[model samples]
Target: MSAPPLLVHLDGGVMTLTLNRPHKLNAIDNPLAQALSEALSSAAADAAVRAVLVLGAGRAFCAGRDVSAPPTDRDLELVQAVSRQIVMLDKPVVFAVHGWTVGAGFEWMLDADVALASADARFKLPEASLGVFVTGGLTATLTASAGLARAKATMLLGEAFGADEAQAWGLLWRVVPPDALEATAREAAQRLALLKPEVAARFKRVLNEVGLARFDRAIALENAAQQALQTGG
Candidate 1:
């Protein structure tokens, strides 16, 4: 039998969500995306869960959607929903990224409050190359993170960048040695988890109110653009 696509564990007020499917580099198939959405929803409702940590099970963080299977509208919705959940959650979300973080995976990482990447991590925006636009509010998130020009270049070029370059572009909070990546990310998450939940939630609410005011609008635009591109409009 195949292992579940997502593994969830709660310890010390921190919820660790691991993307399984190492063989596929933790690609976001329909099942995996749905699982992630459910897990995030559960975490949000649990008072004991103060912070959430997202990590990849294998070498790569996530290589984007599973291309082998034709993605349906439901798949797209599920993927977008997971991204929205991550952003709307009052609890902090920390992403420990390594290896390849491409397409939707990279967008999801952007939604995280704290993103820690391994020295060996690589990132790419493959939407343009795939003849599709980005979804899940990345159009705004990337621009907000790295400025309009850099974000456009990244989306247009579909080029790969190393962890250091990503940090320089303001996409990552920190890049740690590959060996220390896990420990550093866990420490950060634990520290956030130790904060009072109401205090953390209040801060997050204000941050989103100011920084992500247009997040929903951006997602709507992205979804429309992606659908049109998929339909060859």
Candidate 2:
């Protein structure tokens, strides 16, 4: 049997969720998407978990959804669920991105409370080129992160940007050397885990309320657009 697409481990109050489909560059498929959503839901309810850390098992953080296969409505729902969980969870969620982070995978970084990238990391939104649009509130989040003009250029052009460029655009909190990526991300997660759970939750709640007030509406819009495109409407 094949290994699970997601690997879960908890240590020092930080729960790490690793995308394990290295051969596929950790692409998000139906099974992987559902597993990720379930894992995040469980992590949020675990008292011992103070923070969640997401990482890719191999070179790429995630190459986006596996378009090689036909996608189901359930797949789309699971992907959206994971995005919602990341934002709604009281516990901090940190994404440690490396290599190729594109499309839905890039949206994951935006949904995260904190994002750290390696020097080798590259980000892109290819939905426009793929004849679809972004979901998971990325329309709002990307605009907030890089401004309207930049976000428009990115989504429309579907060009790749390096870690330094992403950090400068406010998409990443930090861009560490490739060799230091894991260590820096782990340290950040550990630090977050040290915070009082209630305090952290309160701060996250306020931040989401003020900064992402339009998130739900944006997701709804994106989802409709995606479905329309998929159905050739």
lDDT of 1 at 153: 93
Error of 2 at 157 (Å): 0.9
lDDT by residue (tens digit), candidate 2, 117-222? 9999999888898788787789888998889999899999999889999999999999999899889999999999999999999999999999889888888888
User: Global lDDT for candidate 1?
Assistant: 0.91
Task: Tell me each candidate's RMSD, in Å, in order.
Answer: 0.8, 0.9
Q: Each candidate's TM vs. the true structure? A: 0.98, 0.98
lDDT of each: 0.91, 0.91
Off by over 4 Å in 1: none
Model 2: colliding residue pairs: none
Q: Write the per-residue lDDT of candidate 1 for residues 29-87, one digit (tens) a residue.
A: 98899899999999998999999999998889999988897656787798789989999
Model 1 earns a TM-score of 0.98
